[model samples]
Target: MRLYVTPASPWVRRVRVCIDELGIGDRFEYVQTRWPHAWGTRTVEMPADFVEATPVVRIPALVADDVTLTDSHSIIDYLDGKFGNHRLLAADGPGRWKAQETNALACAILEAQIMRRAELLRIGADRSDDFIAKMRDRGLRCFAALEKQVPSFGDAFDLAQITTAVACGYDDWRYGPAWREAAPTLTGWYDTVAQRPTMKATEPAETPER
Candidate 1:
């Protein structure tokens, strides 16, 4: 199996953390991909087969045997089912729905963070302050929502927690500590989760020049 990734992407990091937590990191090869800039102005040169595997050109693309999974959600689902015995995610029942709900909020926060970064990358004249502000506000709103849901987050470090931690980590790295104000309880939860070896190992970093 080959996992295409960029260190700076929280989406990619989510999958990496899951793989590590499942003790399946050794089963796959990690292929580094890059964006031209931190805000993903464009992709750096990529291998032809990688392009074939992920025509959409997204990170967290996984190629295993005859199957190619694009996008972080699909990759994680595949890993949880195939390699993780549904440990990262529940197979059915109320637990699956609860995990899905929490994951949705976390994924939304990630989307808002990335969109906010893209807006910030624009030139002063081209940037829309209103749009940037909208993304920031949306992310904070989700943070608050997650804070309320944290108590329900049981003992297992499942997919929801992994994704939520990734979102928190990215918000810290890209947008600083402002989100903590909206999610004080979540802030405490994340501080503890961030210490995990998987989280520490996959900390976000600058995309290197190819």
Candidate 2:
């Protein structure tokens, strides 16, 4: 199995952390996708060889078990099913529904973080303060809710926690780490979560994995 990823992507990092925590890293060959540093102003294209397998040209695509999984949620869910000794998603009932609900909220927060990141990457006049402000406001709203809910974060460290952690990590990486000040409780929770071996091992870097 080959997992295509980039070092700086939280989506890829979340999946990597999941596989590492589940003891399934040996089942995958981590393929670091590269784009031309000289693409200049044009949108980047998938490196030629990887284009066919990844329709969206995104990271965290997994080629495994005779199927190609192209999204982070799909990849992580598949890994959990195959190798999870302890389940990330609940078996059924309220716990399952709650996890799904929390995950959806976390994912929306993650999207806001990414949206802000896109705004930041634009150069000078190309950047849009309106978009950045909107995304920043949206993400902080989500963080505010999560901060109130932090006391309920158990020690289990399941999918909801995984997504929440990565969203916080990404916020710190690209958004001036202001969320730490804005959401003190969630920040405290993340400081503890960041110490986990899987989290420490997958902290984002510019260097590509071989």
Which numbered prediction scores highest in lDDT against the true structure?
Answer: 1
TM per candidate comes to: 0.95, 0.90
Model 2 alpha-carbon drift over 4 Å, by segment: 36-42, 207-210
Clash pairs for candidate 1: none
89-157 per-residue lDDT for model 2 (tens digits): 876788878778777778888788767766676787977899989999998888877787677777799
Model 1 — TM-score against the truth? 0.95
What residue runs in model 1 are displaced by over 4 Å at the alpha carbon? 38-45
- Tell me, by TM-score, which candidate is best: 1
| lDDT by residue for model 1 (107-158), tens | 9999998888877877759789999999999999999999999999899999
Residue-level error in angstroms, candidate 2, position 103: 1.4
